[model samples]
Target chain A: MGDLLRRCLMKRTDPDAPQKRRRGAAVALWGVMALLVLWALFNLRAIGDAFVQFHAFLAYRFIRRALIVGMLVSLCASLLGVTLVLKRYSMIGDGLSHVGFGALTVAMALGFVTSEGLPAFLPQGLRGAVARLCAGIAANPLPFTLVIVVVCAFLLLRISEHSRMRGDSAIALISTSALAVGVIVTSMTSGMNVDVYNYMFGSILAMSTSDVYVSVTLSAVVLVLFALFYPRIFAVTFDEMFARATGVRAGGYNMLIALLTAMTVVVGMRMMGTLLISSLIIFPALSSMRLFSSFRAVTISSAIISVACFALGMLLSCVYSLPTGAGIVAINLVVFIAFSAIDATR
Target chain B: MALIAIQDVTIAFEGTVAVDRVSFEVARGDYLVIVGENGSGKSTLMRAMLGLVKPRSGRIVYGDGLEKNRIGYLPQQTAAQRDFPASVEEVVLSGCVNRMGTRFFYNRADREKALGNMKLLDVERLRKKSYRTLSGGQQQRALLARALCATDAMLLLDEPVTGLDPNAAAEFYEVIRSLNRDHGVTVVMVSHDLSGAMRDAGKVLVMNRGMDFFGSLEDYRTRFAEGMVKGHG
Candidate 1:
């Protein structure tokens, strides 16, 4: 009786282990989210009465938009990322992320971002004034920046296309170069921008309504594409020779993968803050696979876990004045460490 | 009908030629085994014919109704794939992916075919087991079932019996023989084992970096033990 009780108390992490822990963690995670929503609702009077009621409502809309967009982008990145990591293409993911950072940096300095691109969400007078101001003082070369990022991505992708070098190595080189360029460009344009820090680590609370639509639509397309090309992706991920033999054309599939990675990375730059977005892509896949078997299960579980964490992380940021991106990562790390420990003990 | 025809094939990696102007033709219901020592280009030639490796110069022509979803290839198992987390059903189902083309979902027929192939291979009970958890013989059988899903036209095995015990190897060859004799599927396999590989193979092609001979298995056996026995030095 004593031994049986000890065994019962000890963790059992077989196939059902994931479902059990997953349910518990999910409940706890969402419980926190519920509390956060309630707390935010609780503080509604404070926000509405003090601030420009417009700004408060605007902030609320922005958070909602950011939540939608951030989750969608993270979902896209994660789906592609699981395969890429399995094929040892994390470096490529990294490089594409740098490409995103490069794009963001340029957009901040030279693009119509003097709040000009702020959509119709802002009043017309402020929008027009910001646009005109952007036209005047913007020093970052927007088109050139986009061009540079593209060339860098293509060059790395092209080299990795033929050679057997792991795509990660090429990604590492390009991403590093991009980050340095981003830093240099930022320093050069200090007097010209409003929030370099915001670009570095996304201020999710600052997102606009239009961003949500863009995220939802783009992410849905990515999910559909993955489903459509599951065979090609699975084949290439596991064995290239066998995959080719089965009629998965290599060149086209490889390029499409690169393109998807780029799109997800770029779209996520605003929410994850270019530096940490890939973690969102990677963590859930690894965590899901820790107990699940099917790729479908892993992918779905990843999305579910990601959305949950993001929601909780955002709420935590709102309540405690924590960095949103960092807070999300922290929560993810804690979950990862907790599960890993549980797995280890068992 | 000749299922596979390769002519004047030359393969080089970097600057070293692995298969020099090798050529062969395989017919329906034929079981042809190519045997050679290590670095003798058996796998290179096999891959070249399957379009896995592009020969420096060669043409591989397949008969009509036999080019698409008609060739099932089994490459040597590397440690990486053996440890992959997958189900036997999932592994076998991938074979039918070629037939799915650009479609998003595989229908019931494909699933039944995958299941039927696993059952035929006598591995139906192993369907739910993690692919990595299976033994070598089981893994090979699972892979064979996967290939069987893609086509009944031709099954190509690259050193399938290399790591198996004699009984497992014999059992595997029996499946190959049945696949050919019973189903009219053509079989092309690469082998380094002399005695076992020759059991059911109707024709034998011997080579060491080039064509050695193409003749009946009995002829190769009778001609065996000569320095360039069957012209495969």
Candidate 2:
């Protein structure tokens, strides 16, 4: 029950603990990660031969991308989530995902080719037709990506700022708006029928090489940045006024985090879609909460959770003919429920 | 030389003045203790000194030529910070973050200093422990250790000894006294314990809405709060 959680969630810094225990916990979490990959690998036969053959070469490379991207995203999210959760802004992840959706919609309308391949949703003819429509919107994809992100970011900032509204509320409200706009815009455009559903649920099997490239690159950048600013972010998270008084530039750092979140949201949308992006960010964190104590531990554990969940999710969706996006979230929900029950027991 | 000088500082929230026209001066290592009832602008005055809020009027001048990272601060237990995931050691190490001016690993010397400071505060044994696991008094010590890492100059404690038992509170007060007398770290503590803290304080500032009374400890003992004609309720 809570015992397992207590062991992992609040255990980060015990000045008195032996280093051996910490290392042991780290290894066990990694072991869990390895087992999950092996499980997924054993069952990857369901991934429809054509797509897997053309894009997903040997088992190692395909698994590596999923594992690497999932872990990296989870690690970054966990590092930021503790602060966000403690600061009571945990809902921002959800809101940002909707903004990502709106960006995707605008990206679609404007026709930008980021080399991330075409959308995997809809019939092949429809994919080309939508591409043509997007092409008609603008010749360049980058500016399309840029404009939607900026607009959504601006709107989100206003909502969170003006009312001093609770962050979760802001996230829920904005995401609903962005998501509704996504539905309305896609519907009005015609011929893009499958687009919203695909985004809503996600298709990990359809994850393009370019999608992995974009997400992983963004993840790497976030990792490096967080590493460098660890102390500053740490101070701000613990005691903002103290951080500010000690010359940590808490305000600047908070703003930077908001910007990073925006980017993470935008890039991550390609995989999880707007509706489920926050799950990718949140579930791994919630799952890892049962096993790690320190901030570093939580970060590491979350990465493990993300990798395991994603690999399992892909296999489960293919076998059950389930929606990939919903399947991932459902698996995480089940895991969370199971853990909460055990936690209550403790 | 006076370390703190304030003139006509007024702070308000949504049209109600928390501190009104407060003015006071404190000499170096003077150990000026502020006494007030709850919501009596004591905390607001302290926040004003820390620049958390801008005052509506007047100015606050520091004779010590304040450095950005020079002041040590201990805030009351804020809900905003109760669940931060830092280890006690890492929490203390944040004191060195600003001082690290250039980027890279925190030089070994800085880390050593932080460890020593934590040791001084007696929370060294909890250094590897999570900041949130420690009890109230221990948490305050951990915070003090963090503050000590920031500067060797002035120390500001806002109701730091509140949740402690009498003995622990006395010990906490003694540490403040030692910091002032031995380390020459100037102390400005906001407290409701007027009688107890008057022992070591060189000066006392009674703040109602603002600085209602300011005098030497001897003067305060002679005539408590002199006159409370203008005070905030």
Candidate 3:
């Protein structure tokens, strides 16, 4: 066992490999990037027409929104993913998505915004004013879901830090519990409805205009915060204790990471679905890590890959009439495999 | 005044005490090596001085124009860092984060400072390489250069040579010795190597959950080293 472990660990460092493979990796990277740019250049008119003709046969209106929101969400996810995945907090995205699902289901069931699940079990006295007061929020369940997921993110951080429970277990506990509640609420109120199915599997058509607005605004906030605190985030992620000793406010940066991740997960869950949203957070970062050595290289490439994957996935889904979420995930997997192959050859 | 003065500082986690009523002082240009067996609170005391841990009762005073945040620290490596995807330059440059002070990105000055330190540690050639790809000695040099970027006046190293081979450990010690003797940096190192660590230190602090001996290295060698070895061996 010890020999096996040592052998596995010894493979991590090969002094000659990096120096020899640098040129090849760079060539492959630029070749792919140039190909993508050329494709975009050639398809510029079709892309522009999609915007002008929203009701076109492909339902370009929904595709346009999904592409915009998907690109932003994935950009934010991949950027944050590099840090979180390094810190082993990648599953926080999965946990938060499950929590978002639970919050959405409960809100719908309580008659917050949906008429279909109108608090049938509520007492007569409490139902009228509660319904009226929450009616405004019902129109957009995003704010409610955002608030809940953000709070849960903070709680998960706290639990992982202070409690004796390990991080993975804490995540598993919260995620499973939330998912169960969502399923129970669904069964209790409206049974297995199309809305519930859409939330689970993610349909590009499920995103409303207001959801797009929220996504754009939140994604902008995420991007700005990430840019401003990039160095501190790197410091904190690399070595928390060292950063703390050097007065980097490690706790504050940790909370910031959690907060940004929560926002991304909530916004992304609308299009990617609770079940598959974490792929947006995990796949790009992992794929980029295979080929890039520097943090900057990995991060920039991850963002570009995420946005490109999302765009290509949307195109495939539009042409083949495939499920948008599955198509994106499949594309991400293919990219990951390709990158791994590149790494192996090098 | 002393660079740092620990007055009866006791550190505890939860209910159990890790360090009990430990007192010591490190003056400017002092090379203080703290030695102890495993779980003897040497590291806890060092952490308390770094302000990573708060004392249960006593005070840790920093004087001699030493800001709490400006002290360079070379901490033990964590598992996460083993596979961290960052260039050597990026890893070293992050040490300038505390000094950046509201600046979002590293400026030209920060880059120059990082490069100068890398040159000092003889790691400038490896700047563009991946950090994880370096050998153990090279990694240590990179981390030491990172520490130098934070401050030239003082350093706090916690078991910096723990996993290094004998040659790498000796080379690291020589680098630190030069930093102290030639550059006049105050160093507080918590190490397990007694005789080897004592060769370069001006002061020796023996810790067993508290201060067992705190004095000049000559006194520790002449009066306390034999008894300590006998007691702990």
Candidate 4:
């Protein structure tokens, strides 16, 4: 590790430095990506058998849903991660995921129960309708959590922009406060249930059928918005003030980024959990940056790296009985280290 | 008509006056240099012209078919851009963003204009290079090309040569001088290197939180040169 650090910090005086190193790094990165694909191809049947052993009923459908949603969310996270990391807004992703967790907890507390604890003066017919509505919300808390998290994301953006507090400090203040609310609400209402534990650490079983639909729709929206506004995002990320002077509406784009980030976090947190979803937005971008020097290269490779990492991690978790979120994070960390080592040697 | 008219501009930030009631006009094909000490509101005034900041009690009237966003600008380098991962072409192409309003991507015309500006700035060879890999002068030239892609009417440069070596600074000045003389472009530069910056200017505005002196270069040389020399020495 010390030697790697020295290699990273020291400037190489090779006669053919930039081009040679750039090519070498690209080769190393693509080699790893190709290896992941070949490995997945070779172990396809084994992985499928392991999934069936892990879950009996609807195992194939569950695995398919997880792959589709997980890969899409990871792609969105990595693409947006390039801009977020570049602008030093990675912590904003972290904060929003925590906010998502908090909102989910609140949603669970508010919606997971029936309308039984209502005031005694309720009418009979109205009481039945209310009870039915409560049951619907109890079954699916995603919409409630989505609304709350999106609002908090915008609030965080405004606070960071207008307040005297630094960006990270504002994030810390809001995230920690939301976390406390979530914990207190959990202790008082839910009393540490498996559902709450699943949301905190993530489990494949946590994904409802409705979650797959929301994740797919929201991920598609994110991908479309990102593609449509790629140039503006690049201009804004490069020099916001300059972009503003050129009439790019930098503030509006910033709001757009915040909105997209909130959506991505809420959807991704279903499988990655609140504690580890942020890694989906951080590791791939950082690793891609280590090996690529151009924005387009970094962005494209980051997306590929993220999807590959998610797929591999999901497979490993299925075969080995490891937690899905931790497994994905471990795979991402390994890729990051591999890229860094290649970069150091180059 | 003047290209840009600054009428009694007063700007304040958080209750502190950064630019007092200052006024100036930039005519077409004119080369104007604003000289000032630190905190003298030079940059603030320029930003107000660019519509990045609003004046407390004034207006910047644009004429000669000039709009706020049409003017080219070469702003000071920020720390974020020092290690940014963008090709020179990408950075240069972004200068045409204002004109591509509501359009998702740059059109063929924008590409041609970017290439023309890159060639004009002698950075066409480095267009494919990463922006962060260029030398300081080359980076400045790349940014200048980007600015040129925005408009041919005027250029607003803020401290363009602050950290450049003397030779590179001279080359940059020559490029600007050619742009003003040969291409008939209006140039407004903010600088502290009074000696080198004042040499090719037709007018000089000496700023000290307001308009201290606004007149021709000859008048400035006669009236303010000795005082400035003594002050600095």
**lDDT top scorer:** 4
Looking at candidate 3 chain B, the ten consecutive residues that score lowest on lDDT are B224-233
Sort by lDDT, best first: what order?
4, 3, 1, 2
At residue B133, give the lDDT of candidate 4: 87
Name every residue pair that clashes in candidate 4: none
lDDT of 2 by residue, A90-176 (tens): 677778777666666765655444223566666777777766766855543434554566566656655765567765577687778
Ordering by TM-score = 3, 4, 1, 2
Q: Rank the candidates by DockQ, best first.
A: 3, 4, 2, 1
Cα error, candidate 3, residue A74 (Å): 1.0
Q: In candidate 2, which residue ranges exceed 4 Å CA deviation?
A: A1-72, A106-147, A150-163, A205-210, A318-321, A330-346, B12-18, B165-168, B193-199, B225-233
Cα lDDT listed for each candidate: 0.74, 0.70, 0.86, 0.87
Clashes of each: 1, 19, 2, 0
Encode model 1's per-residue lDDT on B149-173: one tens digit a residue. Answer: 8787888899999889888888888
**Model 3 interface RMSD, one decimal:** 0.7
lDDT of 4 by residue, A1-346 (tens): 9987777777575546877877777677667767876997999998688767656532578877887888988998998899999988899999998888888777777665554677668876787787777666566777777788889888988888888889899999999998888898899987889877877888876666777887788788888888888888998998887788888899998888888888888888978888999999999999998888888999999999999999888877777878899999999987886787677666
Q: What fraction of the true interface does each of the listed models get right, in terms of native contacts kept?
A: 0.40, 0.54, 0.84, 0.56
State the lDDT at B186 in candidate 1: 85
Which residue runs does candidate 4 get wrong by more than 4 Å?
A: A1-59, A112-136, B226-233
Question: For residues A168-187, could you state the per-residue lDDT of candidate 3 as single tens digits?
Answer: 99999999999999999999
Q: What range of 10 consecutive residues in model 4 chain A has the weakest lDDT sum?
A: A50-59
Off by over 4 Å in 3: A1-59, A112-127, A134-138, B224-233
